[model samples]
Target chain A: MDEIIRTENLSKQYGELLAVSDMSLNVRKGEIYGFLGLNGAGKTTTIRMLLGMIRPTSGSAFIDGKRVFADNHELWKIIGSLVEIPYSYPNLTVYENLEIILRLRFISDKGSINRVIDKLKLSSYRNIKARNLSLGNAQRLGLAKALIHNPEILILDEPTNGLDPAGIYEIRELLKVMAEKLGVTIFISSHILGEISRFATRIGIIHEGRLIQEVDTSQLDKLCRKRLLIDARDKQAVYSSLMQSGYSLSETKDGRFELLDEKAVRNPEVIATLMVHAGCPPTLLHVEEEDLESYFLRTIGIKEDLR
Target chain B: MKNIKATLLPEFVKLRRSGIFWITIIIFIIIPLMMGLMMFVAKNPAIAAKLGLVGTKSSLFGRNDWPGFMGLLLQSLASIGYIGFGFVTSWVFGREFSDRTLKDILALPVTRSSIVISKFIVIVIWCILLILVLFSTGLLMGWLLDIPGLSVQLFLRFSEKYFITSFLTILICTPVAFFACYGRGIIAPIGFLIISLVMAQFAGLIGLGPYFPWAIPGVYTAPAGTEGMQLFLSSYVILALTCILGFAGTIAWWRYADHY
Candidate 1:
């Protein structure tokens, strides 16, 4: 496996607080790894450690088979990142800000600046000072800086901050193209599961400074609990029939009959036929699978009722 | 060589974009003009008395001539240049924290030590330009007023002393840079500057100026004939050591301290 990014039991601690503990993850070539968490969930800390901005208390982080450390300056040449709210020199114009990054990255291709400006749709605000930019433009400028060098891997923390719905969609498409078409690996973090679920090849959920779960996006549906939600004109009759039939039905708080059995969920049409034969033809028959949000909360043990 | 240019260009851009740069130039320009005006007023005692408190203070220039004018410039450079240079250092390093942009540079291909050293170079260049500006402007004022007893040798001697005094004052700026990074803002380093200025004054009064790092620059500006104001050989050693420690501390903090 071409693991572009890997962490080995990485941990970080301040005086009395364990900010991150034993976080180990791997991102292979061209994989969009979504790091999901709530506030104070150690997502930013882990990113910083990956970028070599903060020292890991134990274990190590590697990018392209190189250990991350202060002296490993060459390692950053192929890595792009935005750890948090991106701030630039407020007094400098957007173009000037990007120019600084280009120079620092030792990128000799001057045309990359203009290409990235057009890529992020920041051409209109190119000449304006960063302080004068709207929050969304400032965010685009940050992304532009990160993508200007066309690095092999990107580690972004809330990359869509301060963006409108359209801006978010555009960036999402841009990141998708960069990953699928250009073979760039991305490790993105966000509190919104629906957003990451759209593009992340795999997802990792963190809570209280621990990696609670990691699952491929393709398997998210299997991981999410599914149930047959059944309603009837004669609700009592339906409940009686389902119980006598050994269906093991349960009544939710809203007075709806629910079947959690895999056979019942998988064969909803069979349940429908049984209801028709029992003379309690269901008024409402549908299968409701957990959404990504509920699944995430349930996975993190924050919302137990949903599971 | 390449890294220095890359880091310095952006720092210079930041310096040029700030309103503070123009303000420093204005202050440097006014320092010499204000001294010239004092000499002009002191020469005419009638105007001096009519101006009341201003006139009485102008009398402190003594002869209202080249020697007196150069004396005033030398003393003010040591006193004011210390504050000015310290402010420049604080603004350069501390603004990164205040603006919250330090993270942008932390993981760059450029070494943190190179960035820190680049900032020090900019500070030195800025401080030196101000000193040269003040010196030239004072010379113009001296010639315009045609203060008496001006000679080539005397001018050279005073020029060398003024340059040396500026150099000494700038040496202590390294500590201000350390405080700027360690304290993570302008307030701490500026506060350190103000406190050091006061402590230097107190040390000067107690005849311990040679021993105090902050007071050594001011003592260097003492008049050539003044008794007991001379800098000791050990004073140069102490200043050099303080500078080394300050620069080393700043580089270490940038290299190892947890930015978050």
Candidate 2:
């Protein structure tokens, strides 16, 4: 893959607390890399390090094969970012706020501001002061600022934070188009696992200030634990019959037998036949696939029941 | 240079929209009008007697003429300029942290040094404009009062001293900018300003005013031969060093510190 953003063992320690540790990841060009983590799991810290806002205690980060540094003015020209909950100069209008970014980015085309406002659907709120803007519109303004310069790489931390469902979907589709059509590489951080799995080309889960697991979105289904669930009118007979057939089973909280065996999960009909012959017809039999949320929690060593 | 210019445009835009900016300008304008009222009271004993407290306060102006009025203006600028200019610097730099807008500019194509310099430039311009407003208003008030002992030479001399006092006072605001960045908000820097003002007073009482950056401007405002208020060549040097250090410190903080 053509790497656009890369971190090699990037670590940041604040006093005694390790905010981010040994984080190594790569985001390819035109790929939306989702950085998923629970709150306080080093998502923002890692993003800060990647943006060269916070220096790492050890190792380093790179953009387009160049080392990241706070004073590297040229490096930031091609990057746009929103670290956390985005904030703007509250006294400034949406158009004025975007204009600030456009000027700072040294963008010659003044029309870029209007283009971004229209892109984010913020035309109606163009003259409204940022403090008077709704949280959702404020978030849209933040996104508009990030997209104003048409950066090649975007680093966003919870970009959909204060947005409504429709706003979130709009931003998601916009990012998708930016990645697919404009070839803009994005490294987005969020705690929303299910939401990330929807558009992210690949996802990395961080836990306890460490990158715990990294997998492509397509591989998530194969990695997520799937099981065969069977419940019958007579649970005792079904249990005995499964045990006698040398099949391993575990009981769910609702008194259903769960089979982790690949054959049983792949062919639920076989188990149905066995249950029927045992004179205990299965009232419910289906394969249950763990969702991305559960998989994310499990990968982070947090049990759903405990949570 | 180009980066600083690019950053300055946004800084000016922000300053133009800020409520505090307008409030500071209004306060600066009002201060001279109030001074003129005091001078007017001093010029008339009849009204001064009727208003006892106001009379006694205006009576402190022994000469009550053009030179005296100009000297009073310089003294007030030395003190008020310190606080007012410090407030402007605090708001300019500290609002970024208070409003949580620092991160937006941190990773921009414009250099952090450029941003810091632009903020300082805006602050200097703001403070100078306030001083100009106060001076112009004070001059108009003095002309209306028609106090005696007015001369072309006295006006030029006093104007030069007034501007020098204003310049010295404005130079000290750099340290306030440092505190704004180091303390990460307006309150800490304003607190720092208050403490410095108090310390400047104490330094003057102890006959060490010339050595302190905050007091040097006030010491300069005193009469040339005033005892214990005489400023040496080293006083200017110390003030300049303090200004440089403060400017360097703020820039370094922006360029190197972990904003998070």
Candidate 3:
């Protein structure tokens, strides 16, 4: 794959503390790359350096074969970014804000503005002040603003942080479209495990300013941790059957049964059959595997208790 | 060129949105009205002498009343206009940084210097508009006070003096503009303005106030006579040098300063 963005030993230090250290990353064109990290894990810091918003103490990064710091104006032209939340002049109408950016970029084609507005479904709110928008609408506006010029590369940090469920789904779908149709390589960093997993083709897990692991979507299922759920008609029968199977279930607070198991069960289907044999009619059975969230926690050495 | 236009157009929009643009216009018109009211009240002899508006009235006022009045008023309020300029510059740039709008702007194709220059031009344009408002107010006041036919010469004289004085103000104010860019919080520009005000006042109290940046505003001060024209010309050259040096220093600092 052709690389769109590459960083070599990129590092940033604030006085005595190293915020980002000796990190190298490669993002190929036409790939939806997920940068997963917990809060305060240096993800924002790294993105800031890439966008030339901060100077790295050492090392270098490249965007479209141009050094990030050396050629910021040209590099930024190719990249659209949302660092935290999108902010504009709160008093200015949506159209005003978009027009300012469009004018600054010297984009005279009115079609570009209309296309992005239509794509993000923001035409109705075009005259509304940015301050009056709800969080979901604001997130959509942020995404639209970032996508307005139809940038070839996008670097978004917590893009859907304050969005509702529908907003989240809309963004996920939008990312998929950009990656598939427009061939716009996206670097999205998020804390939500399922959200990134749904759209990202490749995932980079960062913990404490270090790139702990980089895994493809196909390999994620193998890194699963154990979380089992049992749904049976008779609770007593299921409990007895689990005891007989030598699975020690923990005391649960809710109206459901839960068990914490470090030991791997070879097959979850075995437990389902045991419930039937023990006279509990099986309704639903599910095995929750380790996802991006679990993997991030485990890699960062954050205990399940702390989480 | 293209970059300056791109950067400047948005600043006009920003000024329009902030309401300061119009307020400055209103002040330019309204402040001179106070002077007109003073002239009207001078017609009442009983109150005129107490206010000292009667005896001091001279044939000089009859010779060039409108231009002289407008020049005095504009020069008086020049500090106020620049204070407003400082306030606007600080708010405009500071809000972008605090609200994270700078992040959005930097993501565009424009250069950083253009961003700074665009804002500077916007303030200068606002100053120009305010100067026009001052001239118009002066004309209106003169017409109401029953001064004989107002000619274009009056406007030219008023404009030229204000123009020269404004250039001096801009020179003394270069650092204030730079502070607006460099300062982070809401208080930063205000703090710098206060410091300049104090420094200028203190420098004027002493005899050696020429080298100080704040003394540029007082550069044209001369006893009214043939000496005034000579003083204005020499001082204009010195004021031009001050502006050139201050602007050069600001550009140099901007080239090296880390905007982020």
Q: Each model's DockQ?
A: 0.73, 0.89, 0.45
Q: Model 1 — TM-score against the truth?
A: 0.96
**In candidate 2 chain A, what residue range of length 10 has the lowest lDDT sum?**
A298-307
Query: What proportion of true contacts does candidate 1 retain?
Result: 0.62
Q: Where is model 3 more than 4 Å wrong at Cα?
A: A227-264, A267-288, A304-307, B48-71, B147-159, B222-260
Residue B249, model 3: Cα distance from true site in angstroms = 6.2
- In model 2, pairs of residues that clash are none
Residues B1-260, model 1: lDDT tens digits: 88787788888888888888889988999999999999988988899989999999999778788998998998889899898999999999999999888988888888888899999998999999999889999999989987898999999999899999899888999999999999999999999999999999999999888989999988998875666578888999999999999999999999888777
Provide all candidates' interface root-mean-square deviations.
0.9, 0.7, 2.3
Best-fitting candidate, measured by DockQ? 2
For every model in order, the TM-score on chain A comes to 0.95, 0.96, 0.80
TM-score, second chain, candidate 2: 0.98
Instruction: After the best TM-score superposition of candidate 1, give how far the Cα of residue A262 lies from its true spot, in angstroms.
Output: 1.7
Which CAPRI category fits model 2?
high
Off by over 4 Å in 1: A232-237, A273-283, B224-228
